[model samples]
Target chain A: MLAQGLTITISVLIASAFFGYLFAFIAGLCRLSKNVILRKFTGFYVEIFRGTSLIVQLFWLYYAVPMLFGIELGSNWWVGVIAIALNYGAYMSEIVRGSILAVAKGQTEAATALNMSRFQRMRLVIFPQAVRMMLPEFGNYLIQMLKATSLVSLIGMHDILYYGDILRSSNLSQAPTVYLLVLVFYFILALPLIFLTRKMEDISKKGVASQ
Target chain B: MIEPIVTFNDVHKSFGDVKVLKGIDLDIKPAEKVAIIGPSGSGKTTIIRMLMTLEQPTSGDIIVDGKNLWKMEKKGSMVDANEKHLRNVRGDIGMVFQHFNLFPHMTILENCMTAPIHVKNEDKSTAKQRSIEMLEKVGLGDKLDNYPSQLSGGQKQRVAMARALVMRPKVMLFDEVTSALDPELVGEVLEVIRDIAKEGEMAMILVTHEMDFALDVADKVLFLDEGVIAEQGTASEVIEHSTNERLQSFLHRFRS
Candidate 1:
C-alpha cells in the first residue's frame, strides 16, 4: 500500500518539477522582455500565483474551475500537478531574473559590438553563463517542490501521507509504527535529492572553472 | 579625395546635466589612425563608445560610411535610429575594450569565430579558417583552444583584437586597450596594435595614455579638454609641441 503511494508521489514530483522549470524560463524571459505588455503580464502572473496560498490554488483548479467550464476532471491529480508547477514556477522566475542580471554588463556590450542579434546574444553568450549562477537556486526549488507534493493529499490524491493516514486508521494499535515508517520513507526520498544537489553544484563549479 | 570613413558632427552628450562631450566635430579618413588624448573625465572613452553605438549622443549626427548612425531614413524623413537600424550600421565597425571583454565561457578560437559565423553569416569552415589565421596574426595561434581566464592580460587582449579582426570590420575603435594591463604586459598588446595600424587598410581610432605608442602609430592626434578638441595636428606637433596650456600640462604628466 505504501509502495503504491510512493510511486504516485514520485511521479507527481518529477512531472511538476519539469513543467515548473519550463514555465520559470518562459516567465523569466517575459519578465525581462522589452515589450511592456509581456513584462506586465509576467509580473501579474508571478505576483498572483506567489501571493496566494498553494492549497487554495489547488482547490480552485480541482473543484471550482472545472465546474465553471462544465467539464469533469474526474481526478484531482492534474490539478495537483498544475498548482505545484505554477506556484513554484512563479518563485523560480525571480531566481532566473536575478541570475541573468548578475551576468556582467561587459558580456552584453561585447555581444552588441560583435553585431549579434538580441536573441543570438542571449542564447549563445548570456544564458550559458547565467545558467551556472541559476543551478544552486534551481536545485533548492526542486526539493521544495518535492516536499510541497504532500499537500496533494488534502484533495483525495493517495500520496505518501495519505497512505500513512489510511494505515493509522486501519490499525490504530500500530499507529506509532505506521507514522514512524512514513517518516523514514520521506527521509529516504529527500536524502537523495539533497545529495544530487551537492553533486550538481560540484559539476557546475567544475564547468565554470574549466571555462 | 576619398570620403572620410567616420564623421562626428556637432555631437553633444550629457548625463543628467553633466555634459561629457560638448559640440564635438571630427572626420576620420579611410586608413587614417587618430588618437584621442585627454584627462580622465574629458570624454576620451565617450567618443569611442558613441562611435560603437554602445551609448547614444544627445544631439547630433554620427555618420559611419555615409549612413547617419544615430539617425535613419523613415519614409524619406530622417528619424532616430532604432536598434534594428543600429545593428545594420554597426556591421562595418568593431571595438576593443580596456578590459578585454572576451567571452569568458568560450575558447579563444570560439570567441574569434562567433561573430563572423553568427553575425556575418560566414560558413563554418570559412569562419574557422579566418579565425585561425587571425589568431596566428595576433600571436595566439598556440592558445586557440584556451579559455580567456587561462590567458594573461596581454594574451587576452590580443585574443580580443583577433576576435574583432575576424569580423573584418572596415573601421576599428580601441578604447584605452592597454590601460588594464600590467606594465610588463602592456608592450605585447601595444605591439600587436602597432602591427594592425601599420597593415594600413582599416581606419583606426585609439584612445590611449601611451603617448609614445600614440606618437609612433597615430597619423593624427586630437587633444580633447573640457569636452572639446583643444588642439589637433600630426602626432609630433600635438604630442611634442602643443602650445595650449591644458594639453601641455596633460602631456607633461605622461612624460615623467
Candidate 2:
C-alpha cells in the first residue's frame, strides 16, 4: 500500500544519468569530428531531437522503433536507458563542443609545437579546459534531464508519475489527494537536482574568478 | 658565413587575390638579430606568421637552420608534410605573439611546462625544474600557481616568453611581441626580449612597431613598405637617418 512514488522516481533518475552521459560522449565526439558526414549527421540528429517535442521522441522510440525493426524492445530496460540518453544527448553535445572551442587556440598551438598530436592535445589541454567551462552547463542540463525523465510515465515505464496515476484511480485516496501527492513527489525528485545545480554553479564561478 | 641559419628567397604569399607578400629574399647568419619595421598592413606580422608556420605561403621555400622549411621533398619541392614533420620543424622555432597567448586554464608554471612535458616528453620533475628556471628568469617565479587571468597583461606575456624559451629553440620568431602591452608595461617585456637578444646563440627575428627598440637593439633593420623591403641597412643607417624618401617619411611619422 505504501509503495508510493519513490521507486519509480529513482529508476528514472538513474536511467537518465547512465544513458544520457553515453549519448553526450558519442554525440560530442561526433560534433567535434573532422569527418564532414559525421559532423553533419550529428548536427542533423541534434536538430531533429531538439526541434521536436521530447514526448514525441519517447513515443517514437518505444512504439515506432521496435515496430520498424520488428524486434521486441518493449520489455527491455536498456531501451529506456537509450531513449532518455539520445534525447538529452543532443543538447549536451552542443554544450561540450562550445566549451572545447572556448579554450584558447594558443594552448593547442603550444601543444603542437611541443609535438603533441591532435588526440593528445584534446585529451590533455582542450578537453580539460572544456570540462571546466562545461561543468556549469552540464549541471543545468542534468537538472533538466532529471525533470524530463517524468515523461517516461507516458510510455508505461512504471515511472513515479505513473505510480501517482494509479494512486489517483484507487479508492484508498481521493482523486484530488492522490494527484496532489504526485506533484509533491516530482518536487521531491527535482528539488535536490535544483539545489545541486546551484551548488555546482557557485563552485565553477569561483574557479573562473580565481583564474 | 659558413651557411645562413635562416633564408627566405623569392617568397610569395597571397590571401585570396590580395597579395600580402610579394617576392622576397632575406638571410640571417647564425646568432644574428634582425628587426623588421613597417607601416601597418605592410606585412610585418605576416612575415613572422609565415616563419612561425601559422600561415602557409602561396609559393617559395623558407629554409631555416639550413633545411627547406616550406617543403620537405628531398628533390626540392613543396610538401604536404605529415603532422609529425610539421611538429619537428615547429619545435625548433619558437614564437611570441603580439597578444600574450597563455592557456587560461593552467597555472603560470604549467603554461611554461606544457611543451617541455607534452612535446619534448621530458619527465615531470625534469620539466618542472627547467620551467621553474625559465619562470624565474622572466620574473614569474612568485606567481607560479596563479592562472593567466589573475595576472596582468604584462605578466602573462612574460610567462609566454618563458614558455617559448623553455624549449630552447634554435630560432625565435617574435611578431610585434610587445604591441599589446600598455605603454608602461611595454618596457618590461622589451627588457626580457633584450635579455634574450643578449644570449646571442639563437637567431632572433623581431617584428615591431617600437622604432626606438628596433634601432637600439636590432643588429640589422629592414624598412618594409607595401609588402616589399623599401630600404635595408644597419639599424643606424636605416632607422636613424636614411636617404630613401619613403624611409624618411616613415621615420618622421614615428619621430614627430
Candidate 3:
C-alpha cells in the first residue's frame, strides 16, 4: 500500500508539472496578447478555472467532460493528472501574465530600437524575464498541487491519503501516529518548496546587489 | 549636409487631446550634433521620441533618407505597414533613454551583441569581438559578465551607449541620458557621449538639461516653448544671450 501510494504521488507530480506548464504557457501567451479580443478570450477561461474551487474543477473533469462530450475517458489515473494540470494551469496563467508585465518597459523598447519583431521581442526579451518572475509562484503551485492529490484518493485513486485511511481502519491504535506521519509527509514535500522560494528570493537580491 | 539623413515635415503629434509636438519642422544633417533644451513640458523630449519612432505623429510626416515613414500602405483604407515595418525603420537608428534600459537578464556583452546578432545578422565571432571593442572603448570590458543592476548608474548608461554604438547606426538620439544619474556619475556618461560626438562622423540628436554641457558640446541649440521652437541658433546666441524674456527668465533659474 505504501509503495502504491508513493508511485501515485510520483505520477501526480509528473502529470501536474508537465501538462500544467504546457497549458500555462499557452494561457500566459494568450493573456499578454495586444489584441483586446484575444486577451478577453483568455481572461474568460482563466476566470472560470481560477475563481472556482480546484476540487470542483477536478470533479468536473473527472465526471463531467466525458459525459458532456460523449466520449469515453477511461479510468487510468490520467483523469486525476489531466484535471490537476488544467485546474492549476489557469491559476498559473495569472502568475505568468503578472510577471511578464512586471518586466521593465525599457527592455521592450530596447528590443524595438534594435528592430526585433514582436514575436522576436517576446521570445527573446520578455519571456525570459517572465519565467524568472514566475519561478517562485510556480514552486508554490507545485507544492499546492501535491497537497491537492490527497483529494483524488476520495474519488478512489490510491494516493497516500488512501493508504493512511486504510492503515487507520486496520489498526485503530496507530491512528494518531499514522495521521502524524501523513502530516510529516506533506510537510517534508512542502517545506523544501518553501526553502526553494527563499533561496530564489535571496538569489534575486544578490543578483541586484551584484549589479 | 549629407542629403538630410532625417527630416520632420510639419510633424504634429499628441496624446489624446494633449498635443506634444506641433508642426515640428526640422532637418538633421548627417554627422551633426544638435541639442534640444527647454523648460519642463516644452516638448523637447517629444522631438527625440518622434525621431526614435517611439511616438507617431497625428499629422504630417517624418522622412528618413527620403523615406516617408508615416505613410502606411493603403489598400482601400487598410493600413498594411503596421508595427513590423516600424521595427525595420527603427533599425537604422538608436536611442538612449534617461533610464539605461539594459537587458537585466543578460550580461553586458550579450546586451551589446543582441542587435548585431539578431538584427544585423552578424556572425557570433564578429558580434563578440565588436561588443568587446565597444565595451572596452566605454571602459566596461572588465564588467562584461555583470548585469545592469550590478553596475553603477553611470556604468549602466555607458553599457547602454555601447549597446547602441555596437549597431553602428546612422543616427543616435539621446533623451536626457544622464538626467537619472548621480551628479558625479553624469560626467562619465557625458564624457563618453562627447567623445562619440567629437568623432565628427555620427549624426546625433540630444535632449539635455545640462546648460553648460549643451553650450560646450552642441553645434546648435534649439529652445522649445509650448510645443514650438521659440528660438534656435548657434550655441552662443541661444545659451549666452537670449533676447526672449521667457528664455531669460527660464535661464535665471539656472543661475541659482
Candidate 4:
C-alpha cells in the first residue's frame, strides 16, 4: 500500500512539475511582451494564483468547481495536478521575469548592433544568459513544490501522506512511528532534488563568472 | 566627382531639453578616414551614434549610400522608418563600442560567427572559416575557444573589432574604442584599428581623444565644439596649424 502511495505521489509531482515549468516560461515571457493585453492577462493569472492558498485551490478545484459547474473532470488526480501547477508556476514566473530583466542591457545592445532581429536577440543572446541566472532560484521552487504535493492527499489522491494516515487510524499505537516514516519518506524524496540543484548552481557559476 | 557614401544634412538631436547636436551637416567619401576630436558633451559621440542608428535624429536626414536612413517610402511618401527599414539601411554600417560588449557566454570565435550565420544566413562551415580568418587577423587566432572573461581588455576589444569586420560593412564607426583600456593596453587595440584602416576599403569615422593617433591615420580631422564643427581640414592642417582659439585651448589642455 505504501509503495502504491509513493507511485501516486511521484506521478503527481512529475506531471505537475512539467506543467508548472511550461506555464512559468510562457507566463514569464508574456509578462515582458510588448502587447498590452497579453501582459495584463498574464499579470492577472499570476496574481490570482499567487494571491490564494494552494490547499484552498486544490479543494476548490476538486470539490467546489465540479458542483458549481455541474461537470465531471476526467479524473480527480488532474484537479490536484492543475492546482499545484498553477500555484507553483505563478511563483516561479516572478523568478523568470526578474532574472531575464537582470541580464546586462549591453548584451541586448550588442545583439542589436549585430543586426539580429528582436526575436533572435531574445532567443539567442538574452534568454540563454537569463536561463543561467534563473536556475538556482528555480531549483529552490522545485523542492518546495515537491513538499506541497503532500497536500494532494486531501483531494482523494492516495499519496504517501494518505497511506500514513490510514496506517495511523488503523493502529493508534503506531501513530508516532507512522508519522516518523512519512517524514523520512519526504526527506528521501527531496535528496535528488538537492543534488540536481547543486549541479545546476555549479553550471550557473561558470556561465556568470568574470575576471 | 565620386558620390559621397554618407551625408548628414542639418541633423539635430535633443535629450529632453538638452540639445546634444544642433544643425549638423557632414559628408564622407568612400574609403575616407575621418577623425572627430572634441571635449565631452561636444556632441562628437552623438554624431556616430546617429549614423549607427543607436539613436535617432530629432530633425533632418541621414543619407547612407544615397538612401535616407531614418525614413522609408510608404505609399509614395516618406514616413518614419520602422525596425525592418532601419535594419535594411543599417546593414551597411558597423560599430565598435568603447566597452567591448562581447556576449559573455559565447567564445570569441562564436561571437564572430553568430551574426554571419544567423543574420546573413551563411552556412556553418563557411562562417567558421571566415570567423577564424578574421580572428587571426585580429591576433586572437589561438584564443578562438576562450570565453570573453578569460580575455584581457585589449584582446576583448580586438575580438569586438573582428566581430564587426566579419560583416564587411561599407562604413565602420569607432566610438572611442580604446578609451576603456589600461594605458599600457591601449597601443594594441589602436594598432589593430590602424591595420584595418590601411587595408579595408570601408569609410571609417573614429571619435577619439588620441591626437597623435588621429594625425597618424586620419585623412581629414574635424574639431567639434559647442555642437558644431569648429574646424575641419586635413589632419596636419587642423591638428598643427589651426588658428581657432577654442580649438587651440582644447588642444592645449590635451598637451598638458
The best candidate by TM-score is 4
Q: How accurate locally, in lDDT, is each candidate? A: 0.90, 0.79, 0.83, 0.91
The model with the greater TM-score, 1 or 2, is 1
Restricted to chain B, the TM-score per model reads 0.99, 0.96, 0.95, 0.99
Worst 10 residues of 1 chain A by lDDT: A202-211
Predicted model with the maximum lDDT = 4
Taking all chains together, the TM-score of candidate 3 against the true structure is: 0.95
Write out the backbone clash pairs for model 2.
A114-B119
DockQ list for all candidates: 0.60, 0.45, 0.58, 0.59
Give lDDT tens digits, candidate 2, residues A89-151. Answer: 888888877777767776666566555677888887778777777777777787777777777
Clashing pairs in 3: A210-B150, A211-B149, A211-B150, A211-B151
Q: What TM-score describes the B chain of model 2?
A: 0.96
Interface RMSD values for all candidates: 2.4, 3.3, 2.9, 1.8
Q: How large a fraction of the reference contact set does each model reproduce?
A: 0.74, 0.37, 0.63, 0.57
Full-model lDDT, candidate 4: 0.91
lDDT for each residue of candidate 4 in B1-256, tens digit (9 for 90 to 100): 9999999999999999999888899999999999999999999999998898888999989999999999999999999999999889888999899888898889999999999999999999999999999999999999999999899999999999999999999999999998999999999999999999999599999999999999999999999998888899999999999999999999999899
Reference contact recovery of candidate 3: 0.63
Per residue, candidate 3 scores C-alpha lDDT tens digits across B81-194 of 577667667777888988878887789999999879987899999999999999999999899898887899999999999999998888899989988999999999999998
| lDDT of model 3 at position A139 | 79
How do the predictions measure up, each by TM-score? 0.95, 0.92, 0.95, 0.96
